[model samples]
Target: MKIFDTLNTFMLEKVKPLAFRFENQPHIVAIKNGFIVLLPFLIIGSFMMILLIPPYPEDTTSGFGQAWLALAKELSEPLWRVFQMSFNAISLFACASISFYLAKEYKITPLHTAVLSMMAFLLLCMPYQNSSADITYFGGKGLFVAIFIAFYVTELKRFILRCNLSIKMPKEIPVAVAQSFNTLIPILAVLLTIYPFALLIEHYFQASVPVVFEQFLAPVVQASDSLYTLLILTALIHLLWFFGINGALIFIQLWTPFLLVNLGENLKAFQAGEPLPFVITNGFWDFYVTHGGSGGLISLCILLVLFSKSKLCKNIGRVGIVPVCFSIAEPIIYGLPILLNPIFLVPLLLAPLVNGALAYFAHSLELVPAMVILVPWTTPAPIGAYIASGGSVSAAVLSVLLIILDALIYYPFFRLYDKICQEKEANGKEITQ
Candidate 1:
């Protein structure tokens, strides 16, 4: 046991510095910086205007006729198809760029390396006319592996830098201060670049998970007709988000098959000449629309209100408001200091669970409708929430209520964050001005 312990400690000491160096290396630094610069374009181009996709009609005959409605269909169809291709291409480019930068670190030719990367990306985007299921599975897995490899290659360069480099401090500078700055800059740059891309990739691919999650939740949703079950599901989702796991992954793992089962049931009911209790009144509109799921606007509003004091945090909060309302909270989560802040840990977990519970109750009581429509997650808060719930005004109202609840939850943590910022500002003023 003593020998084992000694070896473990020895290994940790060796690995720690290597890990730190890998995170701070130059090629990694360049890729990270580039990723940050490209993130906004990638996110906006991919997610924006999704709500505009038209929904299918209730009647098959009407839908068929609408498809043939030449002038109107021609106008929208080409534009929508263009937007879809453009967004997908942009995502491919972003991932490809990361791969190229990483390849440069290995003394490999960056420009030439991109050919392989782009080929990998093309494979992901290409249509498999014969088998969509097989295509989706293989394409998604391949893309993920490719991206991971790119990151690994970049980190390897950083490792090389750490081995060959050493910093020298100026005579006038304090050794501790110089050392700290040397240690911090590279790591910060890499983090700023890679983390945001991670968030974007996770979010973009998340679209497919719900089809699975809804399936898993169906039997549970149908079992007792008890609102509590929905609350449980909502809480489970919140818990998953808290740990920094992709919330969509949790939903997909638990529910996609069940959702398929429900979908099959709905089709069977339709074939039996019975009116389905809920028809997917509009697939495009419904699938694309999303807002914080059961958590609603409350989660974002709370974060915004709490972070209002710091110039940076306030700016992030304000900028994030529109996205958060629509259920896209990546900006707020990453931009604010919430990632490591102890103060935020509580509300971040609790607020969503509470909001999810309330939403479940309201939905179960028929005060709000179930989300029968698919809509983009980037739709503004109450509006997206309202539309997803089949255009129910009550669901919009509930969304508003949840926003208020979120504000309440975020209040205390925001105060703590504000206090820290204020202290830092005061210290800066004293030192510089």
Candidate 2:
């Protein structure tokens, strides 16, 4: 009891303060919201994955599989063009979207900053060949470069404003026209600075900016898809949630680019009919570790509804069960108040780590294929896993199995907490009577 209280105090005193600071920090806030703002672009572009690749093996014995494959082959070029326009050309939107949200966070001119960010991004990352820009880096491979430009260029623009490096218009000019004119110096600065550096990299290194930067981050990128890294990140996110911090959003700010890179590499492999090179991705994290939101709260909701003796627990379970089925956790988290409650802590923290181990091994052994599609996080876990794994039944089965296991993990703790609540409620009733 003493140890638990001490640990709880430390979390409130030390961890909470740091986490709150990061949450309120403008750049961090923007990155989180920027990803939220960019979801439409990601979802629409990622849906092209379904169209570009048929979900059947080449040598499948089923007639439907064979016919589908034939149709896909016949329509390959048009499908490829559709995909090429969306997912294949994703970085263009990613850079602009993140910059726009980030500019709003800074209370600066969003349109001009977004436009400038895109120009800077294109100048550095895109490569010209045969009178057309190469589209290879525009998807997942280019995401790392896009996010960097989004942050760095936005900050650079802020720095320019801070130093008053932007052009000043005549007093008689309208403010909108004046702000538009103010973008002139930042434009030249981007041209003078970013363009020259890109030219140097091109001439000296024989590579586009994205490729060069990816090479530098190759080690970190490769390590990010490992099982150990997945478990560590999962634990971090849950731990933050345990303290009532928005751990998933906070961690997503750092983890988003890596997850997208993994997603991109997996999509590439799926389209090329090769073994998937990444087992960790946005889909994997969404469906496996966080299927019912942090701490397997959906499972808790189920247990509370079915088995709890306490009225409060039963009410929370009834209200929370539906939203959690779709992966929302707020009602359960705040209502049951999982934060700092030692009774519920272990099950909440441990279930996802357990899921990560089993899921990683299952993927490695090819019991289920690595997810190739970026299914929305809000989609039901089993269904989302099915879609994300390119329509694999086994992925859906794995999600169900994990959910059941999570329910088992939370059961004992749920009972313990319910008994306590039941006692408290009984005491209150007697006093009132």
Candidate 3:
């Protein structure tokens, strides 16, 4: 026990400095900021995924299957056909943003720089028109190259400005030579090392993993008919989001098969008047499909209360409310200090689990109908929950109650965050004065 405790302390001590360093680093800071700014794109991507991926049905032979399947097929067919183009567009946007940022660092005309960046992005993303293979060799590989070039150009300009380097033809030769060398070496290395490997992995994984996960993991999760698996998966989803992976991606990837297999069991249990899944039974809202979120009104209210206190908190809180209402919390989760705050992290992670479990319990007891309808995740909280649960106003009210509960859960942590911010501000004032 003493050894274990000592090891734990040592680990904590090691982690703190690294965490602080990461939080302070400019690149890390930029990525976090960029992520918040780019979140709407991610949300858009998730919606596209949902529209493109066919939802699994409970019955395959029925007339509903024919109708629903036809609908699903029609929506998905065009998306799948044009998926490469869509992916290229997304990559180009990311590259463009990186270029714009790099240009700003060099004190250049960002508009001109961005246009150049976009051109490079397009060049990198354009599909080879002459290729005979069924799959177009999209130059998705060039995205990083574009970003690297942008950064290199920005840095070179900075260096030249600082040193007052001559731009005459003779002097420009050496600068151009140096820039060429800088760009070529990394570009070649990436092409030789990373590009082939990335392509290989992408192809291999694309061929195998989705099918395996669907056939294997889906059934195992569904077979148990236990709420614990769902809880674990939801927790995993939250953990992934914490690491900057979109939570919706995780949900959409695993949800169809998992939902198809288990939802039927859950609904059967609900109809038979037996114990329902633990999430709906215990929590006021079901997160997976019923509501875009778990804590419902409780969590929202808690955040609102927190927002009312501090300027930064208030601003982020206000901005995040609309997204949160639709079960999207990326803005709040990242924008707020909740990511690193020990006080907030506890509830940030646990509150959802608690809510899921409660919702499961409530659902099992037939206190609420098993959620059957598919609603968009971006729909507002109570309204979304109501519509998703077959227009249950009671469910909407419960969602409101859950949001209030979340507020209570979040209050103490918010106070802690507020205090920390206040102290930091005070210290800044002292230094300034």
Candidate 4:
């Protein structure tokens, strides 16, 4: 108890401030908000993917399921085109979203800046002439380049706006028209700035901006695919949560682009009926690596409800269990006070790391197919795994196994926390009596 108290004090005194700043930093905030804007596109596109690629086998014996599969196959091409228009054009959205957020940060007219940024992104990444090209560059594969172009165009717009490089209109003019007039200079400035550079690069190197970034960031991208990187990132995410920051936000900023790129490739490969290519993807994290939300907090809830001696602990668990089942851990994280409570820190941080390691090996060993589909994060475990793995019972079984492992890991710490709560309750009652 003394050690737990000391560690809690140390964390509050030393770690909290750093976590706060890291989460609140301007660029970090912009990136996080930008991803939030992209979340809808990802989710809607995932539903389209599920519609196109049902969980059951494409070839099945006579049954309703078989008929549904046939219908899905018939509709698959149109659904694929829908998915392609949205998911495959994700880079375009990234440019607009990032610029929208950054414009808010810079106090500029968001719509104009966003549109201009999207234009700049297309100008930089797309080919000039009529020719065939790999379209993946316009999707997740081009996210890093899209992000860079967004920032570049937004900063340039900020400078131009500050310089008052605009046609001043009479106050009698309609505000919307005047604002459109005001955007002219910044729009032209961003285009002039990006378009020539893109042409120069294409002229000299015969590659688009996305291609250049892909080549330059290849090593980083490769590193992101490693198991060690996954462990480190997972650990970092949980660590931030220990200090009360939204760890998922940090994870999204640093990791989601890579995860989405892998997901995009997996989707294409899966549609081609080829063996799944990437071991790690968005679904890998959502369904495999962290069961019951970040750090497997659902396991802690289960332990509390089943074994806690303290009435307070049991009640909190009862209230939190429903949400936890759907991978929403906020109730347990804050209500159970796991935020800076050192008693639960080890399990909170360790469980997710263990989950990631296990999931990584499971994939590397060919125990299950790569998760090609995206399941909503709100989807409950085991079931979510089943869907994400395209109806693989093995993946669902693995999720249940991991949940049991998480419960085991959290059991001892939960008991200790329960004992402390019981002691406090007993002491308070005695004083009252």
Identify the leading candidate in terms of TM-score: 2
Estimated TM-score per prediction?
Answer: 0.43, 0.93, 0.44, 0.92
Q: What is the lDDT of candidate 3?
A: 0.49
lDDT digits (tens) for residues 75-102 of candidate 4? 9888878888787888889888988988
Task: Put down candidate 2 lDDT per residue, 1-433, tens digits, no spaces.
Answer: 8987797789889988998898778777766776677677667766766865667778999998888888878887877776777666667777887888888888789889989998888777767768987667777888878888888778888889999887777899999999998888878877888888888887888977888988999999989988888889888898888878888777777788788888888888888889999999999988988888887787889898999889989998999999998899999888887877777789878999999999999998889999888878999999999999999999999999999999999989888888888888988752110
Cα error, residue 329 of model 4, in Å, equals 1.6
Q: After superposing candidate 4, which stretches have Cα over 4 Å from the reference? A: 1-15, 55-59, 131-135, 429-433
What's the CA error at residue 186 for candidate 2, in Å? Answer: 0.8
Task: Give me the displacement of residue 424 in model 1, in angstroms.
Answer: 2.4
What would the C-alpha RMSD of candidate 4 be, to one decimal place? 2.8
Best by the lDDT measure: 2
Q: Rank the candidates by TM-score, best first.
A: 2, 4, 3, 1
Roughly what TM-score does model 3 have, to 2 decimal places? 0.44
- lDDT for model 1, please: 0.48
lDDT of 1 at 350: 72
Q: lDDT of each structure? A: 0.48, 0.84, 0.49, 0.81
**All candidates: CA RMSD (Å):** 15.8, 2.6, 12.6, 2.8
Write out the backbone clash pairs for model 4: none
